[model samples]
Every structure is written in C-alpha cells, then in structure tokens.
Target chain A: MGNVPAKESPPNSGGRSRSSTYSGSGGGPFGPNGSSSSARRNTTSSAYHQSGGFLNGIANANDKRSKKTEEKDRLHRKHLLGLIVRYTENVDGGYLAPFGTYKSNLDYNCDIVRGLIMKRRLAPFYTPLQDFDESWTNEELIVILNQLPLHSIETAYSNEEEEDDIDNHKIHKSTNFYRRQEQKAKLKELMLQMKQIQKEEENKYLEIKSSSSVGQRSVELSSNDLLLRLYRNATECPICFLYYPENMNISRCCLQPICTECFVQIKRLDAHPPHDEEHNSRTNNDSEDLPHTLISEPAHCPYCASSEFGVTYEPSLDICTGFGGIKPGKFRSVDESNDDAIASSSTSPSPVSPRKAVKPRRKSSLAINTPGVISIDMIRPDWEAKLASARNKLARKAATASAIHASNLIMNADEDSYSPSDSRRNVGSSALSNVEQRMIEEALRLSLLDEEERRAKERREERK
Target chain B: MAALPKRIIKETERLVSDPVPGITAIPSEENLRYFEVTIEGPSSSPYAEGEFKLELYLPDDYPMCAPKVRFLTRIYHPNIDKLGRICLDVLKDNWSPALQIRTVLLSIQALLGAPNPDDPLANDVAEDWKKDEKRAIEVAREWTAKYAVKS
Candidate 1:
C-alpha cells in the first residue's frame, strides 16, 4: 500500500487547488527582487533617505520579530538530547561534556544543534547525529561512524528477500566481529542504546503523523527515507533538480547547487569554449583543427547565468546511490533495505539454486536442473511481431515530424527517435523470472485474441 | 535508446490516480512519452473560465532536462508567444530533475495568473500590455473565449 492515508474523498478532487494558489512570492533567499535587492540596500543618505529612516525603524521592528522567531527555533532545538562527548587525546581525561562545551571548533553563538551540524564538527558529535554533506573529506565521518557503537560500520542493508533467506543468516553472523575487546564490549551496549532510540523515533513519527496538521508540515522530519530524515530540510538541488551528490557543491552565484558530478561535467563542457566558439564561426568545420588553449572559460550557473561560481558547501554526501555510505545493519530498517532494491528485483532467481532445486514449490519457483530447459521459442514470435509494429509506428511518427517541423515547428522529434522495440531484448531476459514468463505468455495470448477479433470484423464486412 | 525509466511510469500512474484539480494530462495512445493535456484557466486571471489544451512530451533525457511543452490552443498572454511557447524559467534554466509533470503544470497555471510583462516571449503583446493594460486584458479575455473554448 502507498504510504499516504486512505482517501476519505476522491484525492483527485481534494482541496489541493486552493492550496496551490500562486503566492507570487519567489524562492530566492536574498529578497523579492533577487540580485537587484543588494543595489537598493546600498542607498544610505539620499534626500528622500531622511524619511526612509522612519521606514527603517519599522524594518527594525520587523527584524525584532525575526529575532524572536530565531529564538523560538533555538528553544525548539535545545530540548533535543545531545551527546556528552570527550576527547580521547586529553591528558587529564576531561569530562564528557556537550559538543557545545568545545568553543573553538563549534560556533557557540549558534545553538548546539546548528554548531554541531552546520559547522560539520563531527569529531565531538558522537550520538549518531544528523548526516553531514558530501564535501566533508568523508574522513571525519569515518571516525564518527566508527564511534557509533549502535549502528554496524559494515554490511549495508538492502531491500527484501535476502533477510528472509535462510542461507544469508549464517553469512551475516560470520561477518560480525571486532579488532579489539574494548570495541566488542561497546558494540553490545551501543546496540541496546540504538534499539531504545529507534523506539523513541518511531513514537515521534507516529505522534507527528496522528496530528493531521503536523503531518503535512513535517513530512521531511516524519519521513523514514534516509536522506529525508537526516537532512530534515533540503535534499533536491535547485540547479540539476536531482538529489545533491555526496560531495555536493553550492554555487555562490545564486546559492543554487551544482551537484558534484554535474559540477565536474559542467566544467568539462566549459573547458572547450574556444573550440565551441571556433566551431560556430567555422560553420561546418569540425573542431579538430582549432588551436587548443587549455585555459578553460568560467562556467556559468545553469539557472542564474552567473559566471562567478565556486563550491561554498556540501549539502549531503551522495544520497542518490541508495544509502550506500551507511552500513545496511546500522540504523533501523526503513521502508526497505533501499540500497539494492532495483538490482535484486531484476536478478531475484538465485543462480546457485537453479541446478539444485528442481521442484517448483511456489508459483514463482523456477523449474530447472539442466541448461536450456526453458527455451525462448514460446515468446519469440510474438515479440518479433510487436517489434515490427513498433518500428512501423516509429517510422510514421518520424516522417510526420520531419515533414512538418521544417518551418512550422509543431514537433521537434529528433532524428534519433527513441525506439521502444529496441527495449524488447532487455525485458526478454534469458534468466527469466517465473513471474515475468507468465506475464509474457498472458500478453502473447491477449494479442492473438485481438488479431482474431480484427479478422472476424473483416469477415462480417464481407458477409454484409 | 534505453527503455523508459521507472520514474516515467511512476509519474504517469500518479497523474492518473491523483490528478491535479482542473488539469488532466493523459498519455497519447500513439506514444506514451507524449501527453495530451488540458488545463482550466485559473480563476481571477484573464484566462479564467477557459479550457486550454497543451502538448507535453517527455524527451529521452527528461527529468534531467525540462519536458518539451507548448500550448496547442492559441493564448493571448505577454509571456506566451504566437506559437504558444512560454517563457517560464523552470521550463528552461531552472528545470530540476525533482520537478514532475504535476509541478510543471501547476507552475504554468500560476504563470497564467501572474504574467511577467517585463520578460515577455510575445514582445508585441507585452508592449500592448504595458501601453494599455485594460485593453490588453480585454484582448486576452476575447482570445480565451474564442480560441480556448472547451472541445
């Protein structure tokens, strides 16, 4: 079932439209006018500015309100429990104090949570705190994760079936070990503590969910999605519209993100600017003969078109690669072991069991002891016909688009139109899952019936 | 070309199951990547009480890039040109992979309400909008009534 609550009324007709009314407010963090705000902010002593001072007083009052809001935010975070951290290198064995107790590394002016989180001061924060951004060298994160006795430092969890399998249980046990006795002892204690924390978080999630008003507002905090729960706010980068990569780089130009790999890719595109310019100038000429000066042009922000850009901060370590960094066994189960869900689904049938287990017990069980037992002959003919039909459709679309798009650009169907027929091979796997085979058969039979229906219609016309 | 990603399938399913109010986007029978969409003009805008049709296509590199969309029905707006191409930022520069078909449509609907004459796709329409705001709005109402009638 979908995570959303059961529809009381048709969700399609839900009062979402009212909520979607255009606020006319933009998302720029600076101000309403964006870049233009800075220029207006510079005006200090104009003739009209004397009266503007009166307006400034009102602005100061608004600032006081914002300050109150900030204080309220701090109070909210202060209640949350923090780790009592101690530096192992201390000669006198200093007291295990709150992370804020260390004034140098932490920004004491900010609240404990922000100081520990925003500054990326992970060495002192040992309570399995929030996830840090991708740019943090990943070295400190390693130390912090190691100290986290609760979550396993190895063995990343994945989506279902593997946990249920009897064979994997032994493998999981064999991998559990420690290099030192002190570490071993800590693991058991941490495991108990983590279980308690998980229970508390579960309760918190439910408490929030039960309150219908809070449910909509606190979706990120309430969500069990690894990145969502960790970040507690932003995840999707504004520039690429994708989740920020592990080493996330924020462009200072417009405060939008250029995800790590995308940043690198964008730079590569900017690297051959001279060649590109030359290509444009040369018309039909290839770029091979251009004088290559390795001096790359400054890359512009895709959204803002500003050339001044650099990595200001990392948002979060590469979250897209299926919670790959966090050990699977560490944090409590979320929706599913998300890491290898796609990989496992595609390759569900255990290759080793194929030769040994001949009997088909479940409907999904494959019957195979010998090679080539299940031949492709059954579905091949139908697949070929489907491909042929798809090709015909593609050709017709291509001809239409090309003819009409020359001037009156109704469609800009690129010459390299994506052919759905080409994907048949990918779906027609040799190691066909039992479910997949049945689906193919059902489709083949359905197509045959459709063909008969058409033939009958033709025969009826002849009789008439 | 690779097979259509699961993201496309998921987006299509959600569009059908939990459709945006006053908006319907159905994949064409001929091409699943192509969508035939209809949006009722938002109230309080010049385009109100009008049903406008649109053509939206998810190119192969969709989500990474913006979906190719244009108004099929003629519209008289400063931001939308004669060919019905809109000058919305998200449709070009600000396109993010996180945005789905639903969000894009919502943005377009919003654009109808707040026409940015300063940055216009239809220069002549924008000039008309600037010179005579009342007459421009009247023309818009007329165009919506004539060309954007619900089929």
Candidate 2:
C-alpha cells in the first residue's frame, strides 16, 4: 500500500572500446563511442590482472573466457526462467493490464526483466561512490568483472543462432516448450486474480443486501413479540373483539399497540359526547335545590360494558381510604354485606365514646364519600395550552441559536477573505456548500430582525 | 451473509438502553439488524404533542457506512421531505463510525426543534423559510397540529 522507491544507476564514465560491435543498428552500447562497453572491458581486465599468476597465462585466459561465457549462458537461461515465474505470480496476484490496449504476454515477460534489472541496480553495492572515491576505483573493477557475464550471455545467444539452422525444427520445438510453460503459468495467475477480485465484489454485494434483510427480519420479529406480549396481557383489540395475532395492523400508545380501527373509534367517541334531553332537563331542575357536590368521579374505560349501562362507579381503594378510613359495613357488595356487618360489629367503638369522635367520623365520611372529579374536556385544554407554550419557547431558542451561528459564519468568511495563503483558499473553497450557504443567509436575515426588535425595545425603555 | 459490524451492534445496544427521551426504539427479535422507533416531539418545539414513527436498517458494514433511516410518519421540517427522506450530513458524507442510533435520533429531534433551512430536503419549505420565516414556522406548526399531534 505504500510507495516503492525506484532504483537507478549512476552514469558510466569510461571511454568507448573500438572493438565493441552491435549486430543491430543502434547507437553505442552506452550511446555513441561504446563508452559503457570499453569501461566494462577495462574493469574486467584490471580484475584479471589483480589475480596474477593464478593460471597458465594466455591459454588459461582463453579457457577461462570460454568457460565464463558458457556459465553466463546458463545464468541467462535461469534469469529468463525466474522472469517467467514472477510474471505468473504477478498475474495471480491480481495485476491487470492497463486500460485501452491489450499487452502481449511477451510484453509482460519484458516488464519482469526490466523490474529485475531495476532492483539489482538498487542494491547496496551500487551505493554512490563519491564518499569512497579511492576504493571505488577498485570497486569499479569488480563491477566490470561482474558485468562480464552479460557480454558472454550475448555471445552464447549468437553462437546458438549458427547451430540453430541445422536444428531449426528442434530449436522451434524447444522454444515452443518454453513458451507453453510460460503461458500456462501466466494463465493460472490471471485466473487466480480474477477469482479474488470477483470474490471481493460478491462479498461486498452480499453485505449490503444481507444488512437490509436482517433489519427487515428484526422488525418483523419485534412486531410479533409485541403482539404475543399484548395477547398474554389479556388486552384485546376492541374493533376485532379478538386477541392480537403475530401479524396485524396495530397502533401503539403507552407501550401498547391497539388496532387502528379501535383507536379511531375511541378518538371519535372522546371528541363528541351525546346529550340525553330528558337527563339534562332533570339535572337542570335539581341543580337549584340540591347542594353542589364538590367530589368528582373517576372516568371509566369507555369500551367497558358498565360505561354504557350507567353503572360506571367502581369501589376503588381511593374511595375506601378517603371515607372515614373505610367503615366495615359501608361499601360492601351485596354478596358480602352480611359478613361486612359482622366485621363491623367486632371493630365498633364503645357505646361510651364522646361527641368528638362522632364529629370526626362525619367529616371523614363526607371526605371519602365525595369521589374525586375528572373532566375529559378540562384536561384536553390544559394539555393544549402547555403544548403551545412549549412550542413558543422552542421557536425563540431556535431563532437565537440561528442568529449566533450566522454571525459565526460571517466572521469566518471575513477571516477567509483576509487570509492570503493558497492553502487557506483551498480550505474555504471546500467549506462552502451551496445549499448550506443559502440557508445561512436566511438565518442571518432572521437574526437581523430579532436584533432590530431588541434594539427598538431598548430605545423605548431608555426613553421611559 | 457477513457478520454485522461490531461498531454498529454496540451503537444499537447503546441506543436501546439509553434512548433519546422522546424516542422509543426496539430492535426486531427475529433480526437484530433492524429497528422500529417512535419519537415524541420535544415539548418546546412546534412538533410538541406530535408522535412520529421511523424505521432504521443497518448495512453489513454499518460502522464504516451508515444506517438507512426513514420517517414513517409525515412531518414538515426543512430537512424532512414529504416522502419521509431526511437531509442530514451525519446520514451522508459527514457520517462517522462513532455515531450511534441515540445520537442520530437526538440529532433528528434537534433538527425538528430547529430546522436547517440552509440544507433543506424540501425546496419549497426552504424558500418559504428564507422569504418569510414567520409563515414558514406557521406552516410547520399547522402540520404538527393537523398530522402529527396524537390528539
């Protein structure tokens, strides 16, 4: 993922060798005058001279040269084989050809060769010679000896050409063999790379699809669970008059999902109350003579049967606690009335109890007997008022914040304009969002209005 | 299917345990990747007393990406369109792995409280907000009263 440093060679500094020849028409081995070839030859000869008397002079020199040439040929073949291996590896590693044009397999082989040579030049041994100029002379000689193999390799290839004519068919067969092997390796690598890329893409696609699917599944499961819990709680949908199923349309309120149809019905009933003309007339007539009752009753569930039958009162704990600490016989049901009387007798006060006790009991009875009042209509208006006030407060806060944000943006813009650096300009250019900029402008206008209003108020106060 | 990203799972759990006050969210039992949420309007905003529903779905690479959230309930805010789509940076380019459902919902609630007309999803709302904020706010309040309020 990081950049790899490129390798380069220093310029060669020796004169050209007149003996150097090129079969193909081109410039010198290292440009005009064959400077590189002469330099290399000199370096090798010096190295040979340094190893004096190690062999039988002239004859040994020729023999050594021939042997080295043969070795060079072998090494060249090995290098070619290595290049083939690397090409195949790169293909398998998912390297793709450049867009627009198709590169021949031979081109790939050439690239491998170039890469190897470039790497070799970057070796530590080829470090700059300026710091060790004195030793570099000798080092240069060794380098020349090291490069002698390149010359021999070229010579070996030429020698093979002369013999190639006699064994033309065999030579072709061998070349074909090498080509096939190289091609096979490259093909395998290409297949591997293709598979790897395909797999990666496939995985990415699956991830996106599965995530949404999982989310959907989770929603369904939770809905089902909610339905089950509601069923277990013994709550039924009023509209269907049936227990909730795993799948059904449900609207939630207070952690409960009611059927939408039932909810609509409840809303409708709560919004409108039917008036009974006879009951109203009777109540109007009694209102003048009867004492006003301060106590209000709790509202019963609208959907309950008792609500429709005019039998809405329920004997709740609040009723018991409020009235004289709940007298034993007082509010007993018909079935328990006899038992209640007996219990009352056991807990009855002594006959000798004073008038004070009787007074307190009467006060407590009045308090308890008077049920707490709840008016659906009254609660609704109070809630509406609260909601309105809250909305107003939020609007005020939003206006203030928006003003501050606008001022900050203006300040930033001013700063940006004053700054001269190109980097700062780049930063500002990127910061601007067309939509956001427009919104800010609107917010600024609002801020200005608020500011004007505040200023006007201040002026009036000062005058006062 | 690839396993859910660890960051997303952690964020989801956090959102569930310490949900935004007005927002009630629950992961689906059948699949832990999806969430159903109900958000109550903040008392101080024009949306007060309004209840809005939303759906959130996590992608496989959720933490590295972003959850897909869409309003199921109709709303009238500069950043929220009639189609229920929202235009917020956190849901787009500004998305960071650190953001969670709680933060997202909170951001959305904040957005309702103070719509960014500058980055609106609804062009008409933005134009009205720019030309006459009072009218824009009135429209928003009207929508809340008509469509969002539970009553």
Candidate 3:
C-alpha cells in the first residue's frame, strides 16, 4: 500500500497552518522576511548568526507564552529530532552507542542518540506519556516536543538552498562539503538547545518527583539503568518502518536499524554478464567477441548505497544467552545457517513480513552470495544456475568459433581438439595443447565478436 | 489496490497539516495514492506567481521507487518536456526513500526558478534559452500567464 489515505488529513488540520504562522513571530531560523528566496539566499552567509539568535530567543522566552508558543515548542522539538535523524544517517553503531570508533565525536553522537529516545517512532514511546498527568514527566514532554511536523522546514531550508544556487550551483558544487560542515555546526547548536530544554523539563520533573512519593523507584532509577532499559527498548526499523527491540539487525555500512525481514529482501540487481561494461565500451558497436558469463554484483546498503550490502544481527542477551548468535564486528553475509538462527530466535515472529506482505515484486535475478562468506543465501538462490549457463554460452561460442577455424588450420588433429566436447571440457580449465590453445584463442576472439552481436541485437529489441 | 502504508498516511497528514509554503498537495478521494498538487513559482523566476499544477501518483514501491510525477499545467521550460515528463535526477535515479512528496515538489519549484538549458528536456526551448535567455524567460513568463495562471 503505497498511498496515504486522504481522509486522515482533516483531523490533523488543527495545527497544520501553525508552521508558517510560527515562523512569522520570531523570524524563523531563516529570518525576518520569512520564505522569500532572497532572505534564504542571504542566510548562507550569516547562517549561524540568525540560527543562534532565534534559537536563544525561544530558549529564554519560555514562560510568557501564547497558544502558538506551545505549537512553536512542538515545532522546535521536531526540528531537533530531525537534526538527530540526519546526524545518525552516517553514524556507525546501534541506538544506545551510535558513535562507533571515532571517540572524538562521542559527545556529538551521544546528544543525537539521547534525542532519538524522544522519537515517537520508538516502540516504548508509542503511547503518549502525557495523558496520565497534567504535569507531564520529562520524557513525556520531550516526546510531545518531538511530535511537530518539520516536512515544511526541511523543504524550505535544505531544498531551497540548492534551488537558490541553481544559477551558479555548479560553481558552488562544494555545497555538499559546506553543507556537511554546516550540519556539524548546526548539530552542535541544536544539542545545546536540547540540553537547555531538557534542563527545564528536568526541573519540572524534579518538582513532581519531590511532591509524589509512591512512584519513587521508577523516577529515581540511575542513568545506567535507564541506558539498560534503552538497550531493551524497541527501535523503529528505517527500511521496513516497523518497530523492533534494540537488537534489531544493523546494516553493515551505516549501522542504520533494519529488521531481518527487510534485510533478507535486499538483493543484487541482475548480474551484469561479466565484462559487459568493459567489452561493450572497448568496442563501441561490437559486442560479439566478449565472454557471456554472468557474475552478480553484491547488493548495496539501501540507506548508504554501500555495495556488497550485508547485515549483522546481535541477539538481545535478556532473551537467550545472546552469545549464541553472530557477535558484533563480524561481516558475515546473511546466509541460510544464520537465517535459521535469526528466524528461530527472533524476539517475536514479525507482525508482517514486509517482503511477502508489501513488496514481493522487488526480487532480483541474483542472491547476495559472494565467495568466502558462508552466510545466508537469502537472495541469490540461482547463482549457480546463472554461472552454469554462462559457462555453457562460453563453451558453445568457443566450439562454434573453433569449428569454423580448426579445419583450415590443422585438419583432423585440430578438429578433434576443437570438437564440441573438447571445447566444452576445456572451457572450465586453462591447460591446453599448442594447436588447441591457438584454436581456443581464435575462438575467444570470435566469441567476443559473437557476444557483441548478441548484445547489439538485444539493444535493438530493447529500443523497439 | 492494497491498503495504504502507514508511511504514506503520515506523509499525507503532514503534507496537509503542515504543508510547504507555496506548495499544496491534497490526496485524491478516489485513490489515496493519487495527489493533486500545485506549486507556486518562486518569486524571482520566470514562473513567478504561476500556480503550476502537477499530478503525483505513488507506485506500489514508493520511497523505494520515486513517486510518478508529471506537470499538469504546461509552461515553457527546458527541463520539462511537452508531455509533462520532468527531467530531474531525483524524479528518476537519484530518488531516496528519505525524500518525500514535499521535497519532490520543492525540487520542481526550484527547477522552475533555475532552468538548466544545458541539460535540456525540451530541446527547442533549451536552445532558445541558451541563445537568448532574456527572450526565453519572457516566453516562459508569457506561457505562465497563458496556461499556468489559476482562475
């Protein structure tokens, strides 16, 4: 189901128009002129100055509020959550400790993960914690803060930045480099704002905690205990967009959360017949002489587009021994043996297998099997068949070419060496007699021409 | 024909609830996946003040596949062809699931603000754009007035 129901629009309409209006009062992160292209263009120069002033104003002016202030706070929290989401896009570890090896970036990544806890997408966060009390808990308010819509801000700020430069965009192609730098700086500023907001919420929570004695144990839990609980919390998988426990499968490249169901669905695109590009490019119009064996490219990470896409699943220790499954830091491709370990031990049967339930048509011709990784053959079930056919095509092309030339070169002996069976047998090995070697070389040359002809024919058919 | 994904529903809700400025996307009543959209041209561009209409349809594998978008209101531009097929990278190969309808529409709006004649989808328009940018922009403005202006 790719479509969103239009009927759902009306109910959420109450706070819909508040974004543009909110940006109006205290010049948005952009500025006084609001969304005019010129104001946005000037932002590129004094970016930090405007963001700092606007963010500080919102931070300081907390008490004397309007009804719009609540909505504005919601928008601010959502934007902060968005910054965290974007920050984690390239981070290398799981939810609790997302900063992988670069200890230098630990403080930076920690702030992002801390912000991630407030995401409504997280399983434990599904129910609004605010309904229980008028004076909401720190976490509850933080979650409420995370609930505003930033789709408009994202479009206005990021997309417009690119558009504004479309005239001289090429000259400023260093935009990506600058954007990364800007993100890091912006992330730093937002983290400080988050800390301030959390501090205020913490003050309120402390007052509530002091007044209430019954629920002391829950409120007084140590930060370490909270971390442990966070480890046990359910994370929403970015690919399948479903929630799962913290130990959900992690993509090898960017460590983005993915479920096992979606992990197995990742497969390589139709394996290019080996040397397809090189041979095609080498002899522009001639595809007849190239070899026809097909070797599949490894599937890439959907999040990062990192090739040879694979995932490592760490079992939650609380469920079982947790030591039974593949340990972290292992780069095993998702294979059958591991698949069983994963399937049998998955915390719960997935509510819906996204592959079977939603996207059954995304199957590719090749599975993810590469040599040396004895992992799950989840996608590349027919790799052997594909390789065999490629061998068959090579043998046939060799035999036909040898048959054409062998009789002219060395009568009976070469004809025997060039025989279909001999060519077929020798296609798999390199050891050959002098005359047979020459015949095969000649055959290979002719085979390249044959491959070119076949491809050209296919191209013509494709065009038609 | 399948039930709508939650992602689409959420995206739809936000697209309406917190709509992008100068851009409005309303899902069709008949088919939840189909949306009627209008992007007001950027203020400084040839398409300024023009409310260009576009039809957006999410295929079975949206976010995996890009939403199928085409211009409904015609105007002169280099990157948009006569059939309303837009020649933008994000609309085709560069699409990521992270991108949403708002981003795509914003991109279209941006494309209008800055048409790259070098990468022309409408060859004759692009040629004219390169030969005489002033005249080409004038024609774009004329087309905007003639066809894209909403009654």
lDDT of 1 at B109: 97
lDDT of 2 at A129: 12
What ordering of candidates by DockQ runs from best to worst?
2, 3, 1
DockQ, computed on Cα atoms, for candidate 2: 0.03
Residue-level lDDT of model 2, residues A1-464, one tens digit each, is 00100100111211111111111123333342246544544532443344344323334446544554455445444433332211112110111111101011111222332332232210000101111122222223223222211011111111111111111112012222343455445555543454344345335434543464555532211122221121222333332232322122221111223332222122102111123221224342332222121112222223331121111111122212111232211332232443343335433321221111122111111111233311222222222323333333334334434534554676587575766778766656555443245444543443344344434534443543
lDDT of 1 by residue, B31-110 (tens): 56778889999899999999998877765445555676778889999998877777787886456555789989999999
Candidate 3, residue A300: Cα displacement in angstroms equals 4.5
Across residues A1-464, which tens digit of lDDT does each residue of candidate 1 receive?
A: 11111111122321222111111122133323345433433321121233444445445556544554455444433322222222221111111123221111111212332232333321112122333444432234333333333221111111111111111111111101112233335434543453355345445544544463443534222123332223222244443333322223344444454433233223212123233333125332332223233234343455555442343432232221211223222332133433334224423321211111223222221222222121112211122333333333333323323322231221222223435785544443322333333333333333344344434534443443
Q: Every model's DockQ, to 2 decimals?
A: 0.01, 0.03, 0.02
Q: What is the interface RMSD of candidate 3, in Å?
A: 14.3
The order of the candidates by lDDT, greatest first, is 3, 1, 2
Give Cα-based local distance difference scores for all models.
0.43, 0.39, 0.47
lDDT of 3 by residue, A1-464 (tens): 11122122232222222222221333334333335534444533232232344435434434432433344455555645432222112111122222111111111223332333322111111111112222333344323323322111222122111112112211111123344545455555655665454345445544544454354422221221222222224455564354434455455556566653344344444444554333115342232344454566655566776566655443323221112222222322123443443335444332221111122221222223532121223334444444544544544444544443443455445445665675745643433354445544443443344344445534443543
